[model samples]
Structures are given as C-alpha cells and as structure tokens.
Target: MSGAPAGRAVAWLPVARPLTLVPAPPPEAAAAALGTVWPALRRALAGDAPLAVLPAGAGPADAARAVLRPDRPLEPGTDLVVVTSGSTGGGKGVLLSAAALRASAAATLGRLGGPGSWLLALPTSAVGGLQVLVRSALADREPAVLDRGEPLAAALARLPAGDRRYTALVPTQLRRYLADEPDALASFDGIVVGGAATDPALLARARAAGVRLHTSYGMSETAGGCVYDGVPLDGVGVRVAEGVELTGPVLAHGYRLDPAATGEAFADGWFRTRDAGSLAADGTLTVHGRLDDVVISGGVNVAPQAVEAALREHPSVADAVVTGRPDPEWGQRVVAGVVPAPGAVPELAELRPWVAARLGAAAAPRELHLLDSVPTLHTGKPDRRAVARLHGGDQ
Candidate 1:
C-alpha cells in the first residue's frame, strides 16, 4: 500500500471495488467481516484506487453509482468516503485523504504515549470504529473486537496485550464500563471515548473505575477525533465563534461532490461545526449542544440540554434526555424523557422543582416522560429523532 493501511474500512481499499464499508449490527461481526471480505477486497486493492466508505446499508452498487458523487467532487489525494447523517436526515459523504488518516492516528498515538492495539467497540462502518482499525493497521497490530452481546470484562480479557494498548468508545459504551468491576475498566492503557457528547458524571465514574478516560470531540470530517480530553491534538486547531471551527491536518478535504454544503462547512480551511460551544481562558472547549437545539418556549430561547442536565441530577433519575414538543401557549414546550435508577421512581412534580431550583422555571420540563432507557442508534448515540417520535414530538 502507498500510504499506511487505514482501519477496517480502508483495509478494504486494496480489495473491494470502491464499495462502501457497510456497518452491520454488532461491532464484532463488522470487525470480523473485514477479514472475511479480504479476498474480494484484496483483489480490488490491487488497482491503487481511491475508495469511498459509506455507512452500512448504503448500497452494493459498484463505484459508478456508489461513488459518482455529484454533490461534492472527490479531490485529488482522497481515499476515504464517510457519510454523516445530519439532524435533518439529509446526509453527505465527507471526503478524507490518506494523509489525513495518518495524521489523526499519529496524533492519537502521540497523545496516548505510543501506538498499540485498539479495542474495536464501534461499528467499522463509522469513522470511529474505522479509525481504530486504521491505527491498528499502522502499528501492525491486530485490534480486539468487542461483541456488544458479550460481557465487557470477558471480551477485554481476550485481546492480545501489547506495548501500548488503547480503545475507542462512545459515551454509551463508557457508561457500561463505569458499572463494571474496576480491574476490567483498568485493562486499557488509554480509552479514547468519542462519537457523541459525554456527560461529566459518566467520565468521572469511568475514572473512578480506574479507566484512563479521554473524552474526544470530532466527527467523520475530522477523520475521527481532533481533540482529546478538551485538548486539540498536534497540528489541529479549534476556535469557537457561534459554533466550533476546526482546522488543520486532521480536517477532511470536503464533502463528496456537494460544493454548496462543502463551501458552507469549510471556509478558509476551517470546518465549521454547528455545535454551540465556547473556549475557556485555558482554551478548553465546552460544547453547549447544537445551534438548532435551542427551543423557543414562552418567547424565550431555552436549551433542552440544560433542562436535561438538571433533571438528570435527581437521585431518582438515572438518565434524562430533553426535547421540545409543540404547544399552542409556549410555541415549543420543554419535554423530558427520564430513566429511573434502580428502586427509584421519578415523578413530574418531583422533577419540575428539582430543575426549577437549579435552573429556574424556564428550564423546568413542562412535560415529563419516564422511560425504561433512552432510545439509541445502533452506534449508541441518543436517537433523538426516535425519542421525539416516542413523545409524539417533532423538531
């Protein structure tokens, strides 16, 4: 291979006929599928061609249909195609180069002390999981595939130990480990957790469980994570205006064939993330959710995450997700979906004041819904669209 072989998805670069790396359910099978698809992939790999990596269930059609990107033309030196489904269900493929992938993996390895094996806990179809495979490939190490169905401890025990061990996980995966025994959590030398916003409590608990948790912030466009534990990795840049703007080596080339969207997203080489965030005096970035997440309630803009965070502070509430439901009086009323802790029952009356005391009445949930568990995508991020449907609400 000309460039260092990328993760599980790009591993197929040498084999598959410029096909999308589809992510099937259960990360282990997706991780294992890479090897099984190798022969076909290996044959395809011979052409030294560039490939597009789309989400699973994209298509089996050849590159003409699969990669004939009219939205944003693939630039020279591009080798990876990643799809990012936006909040509106309108998605686009983010074009990344081999240089970008290596830069990201190198920055990660540098931050973590050195290269080593990785625990593949996310779907290979996604950039998060793909990066793990890429990093492993660059190090010439085999990654340990964690089956979501198995016990985390047992799965971890099976991974071959190496000089420097690391794993990538989303908040949902980290939450599971926070409950496991301490030793099981300590097995990884470094745990690079990203994919979606992470609750501070979850990170604290993970650390308490002996996990060297590093909260990361990035997306497919960044080739994975450009920030680790609130620090931008080497050669990466971060600044917040109305939202976060990320630049530097880790940044993606642009969207595949979508000039309008690409121009809107990448201006002056800085990719503008629609996430509302701020920089501290020390330059730590604190994300406040998406710009669209702000809801108008009674002629005032209220952040649902603020209400959600306040509700989740209740001992009876194990987890909380907040959204807006249409209301004639308020335009959009604040709504909360809560998961109760064991032996605890959360009530609207109890929750309202809990949030009111901390965040005032404007931040209190006008409607309450106690859930068994939050609805999540297969990749383990909150399925807010599904949650909205669960409450008969639309945003």
Candidate 2:
C-alpha cells in the first residue's frame, strides 16, 4: 500500500515517505490479495497508520493524493478504509478500527459454528468480499476465490475440497448458482447472501434444496453485516428509528475525510441505515425496503421490491425489476420488467391476477415487459436508476 499512513488520522502522509497504496486489483487477483490486508491492517490499528484499499483501476498513490491531509488525521485505532458499493448512488470510503473487524470476525465465526475456510466469490473491494478475507485471515487459513471472469460452476470445481466450504454472495449470484449447479452450491457448509433484499419464494426454494442460506443486513459503515439471518451477532445491537439503527463493535470509525457525511450517518454510537425495517419482540429484524424505495402510485406509497418479489413467484419469471412510471392519471404507475424463464414470455393478463392475489390490486404491476436480463452494476447489484430508465423503454 503506497501513500497511506500507518497511524489512525495522523499526519503520517506528510512526514513519512510516500507510501505504497493497495490497488483494488481486478477480481482475478482478489483472492491473492487476501493476505495483504492483515499485516497492513494490524500495523494501522496498532500505530494509527491509515490504509486505503483502492478499488480497481486506481493505484495506492492515488488515495494518498486524493484524501490525505494534515488537517484530517485518522483517529487512533482506525485501520482500514473499505470502499462502499455505490449501487444506490455514489460510493464512499468507510473507516473501521481493528477492534471492529475482529469483533465482526469473532461474532461471525461464533454464529457459524467455529472457524472454517471461506471461498471468495464477491469482489475483494467490497466489504462482503473483504470480510471473507478478514475472517479467513483471523482463522489463519487461505480462502478459495472464484475469479469473476469465469463461470461460477467451473470456479467451484477448481476449489480445494476436504474442508468446510463457506462463501458470501449477493442474492442474484446465489439464485443463478443454485439454478445452474445445485449440487455444487449445496456442498458448501454455509452461504451468506446480502447486497439486496431477497424474495421469500427464493429463500424457500433454497431451503428446500438444502442450501444453508443466511440473509444479512448492514452496510460498509457497520463493517459489512452485524445482523445475520435476522439476528444480531454477539456485541451487535439493533434499533428501529425512521429506519434501522445499529450499534456494535463492528461499527466503522467513520467515513474517511468526510466528517459531514460521517456525522449524519453515525451518531450516538449507532450507524443509521437507509433501509426501512422493524425489530421483532423476539429480536428478528425485518427490513422492508430502502426508505427511498417507495414510489407514490395513485396517491399510495408503493414498494417496488414487494411487487418484484411477487413477480418472481411466477413460474415463467426468472427475475424481475419493478418500478414506477409517471402517469398523468395515476401519478405513478407500477411497471415490471421481467426476465422470462426459458421459452416463457409472461403476459400482463395472466400476471395481473397472479400478483394481485398475493399483494392486492395496488401492488400489482400495471404493465409487464419482457427483458433478457436485469441491468446491474459491477458489484452485481441491480442498477435501479438504469432499471427505472428501462421502464421508459431505454434499452
């Protein structure tokens, strides 16, 4: 890592020689970079050195030049800054302490029944993928990586067997993997899925197929996910304000060099999330959707995810993205773009009753369109802006 200082928020960048920065290498090299973060992070936490893990296409020297300043030194104990997946909007660097990472790793392992080897399938630049490295590092084990360029099944075939296999995947990846190679996915001892809200129908199918799926909730600010499978890990706390608020050892120090952004998101030791959810009396946290997810349709707040989830239940629908289109009469009309199953083209006539039966008339899509696939960001998450554009026939 170049240009990044070793101490938390110290003016190390100005005083010390321009350091090497950790380039966010391509996915092909993500697994290989797993070992690099440990020592650098250790040094950073112990001495307050700042380590910036730059995403691919950028080099270590860039982070130093971009954010390092004598006026804003990282606080003591700040270790690593992982970039957020800007799927919703712009990405930001989240600063986390060594203790936060350790707490996350320990709590995760305790929840998952001791330490085991993890497989790297998600990008190392993202917290989901980086935490895989962190967990594996803490366990003193090397994780297997499935290069992004290759087919998932082929990559799984290349993985070393004989140890308990664990991996984290976004819902899209898991759904595709389960459809393509059920046996291979079932071979894993655990599979953590996040990055977006998962449909209940999908989860049921996964469970029936014997996939140990764990849905997680948290952003980079929470050091990845402090809540796994609707339950908070040890030392993790959850509260519901306008949305969900989390306080725990896994919380990040703050956003790097962006106090205004940090102050707004983190306060009273709790990191507030954009997701709208509720906490059950038994401690189950049910995340409905993002607070910004609602679209006013005919004077009613409509959650497109709920509509999309219902659409996915159709046998002919392989995947779906639901959005609201502005209409003169309705204000916003619900529309759905569906990736049809092999040889299936869903029509609105049949799809309407299908959704209305489950989610009521208001939630039913007013229009249905066939799509080859859903538009996604590099992080393999749905590009909502682009998807919304698709509603206007922006192919």
lDDT of 2 by residue, 3-103 (tens): 65566574544443222246555776665565675455445545456676656654433543365433445554566777665655656768777778878
Error of 2 at 70 (Å): 12
lDDT of 1 by residue, 71-145 (tens): 433465567666664444555677777778888988899998898877777876567877887787677777777
Error of 1 at 140 (Å): 1.3
lDDT of 2 at 173: 86
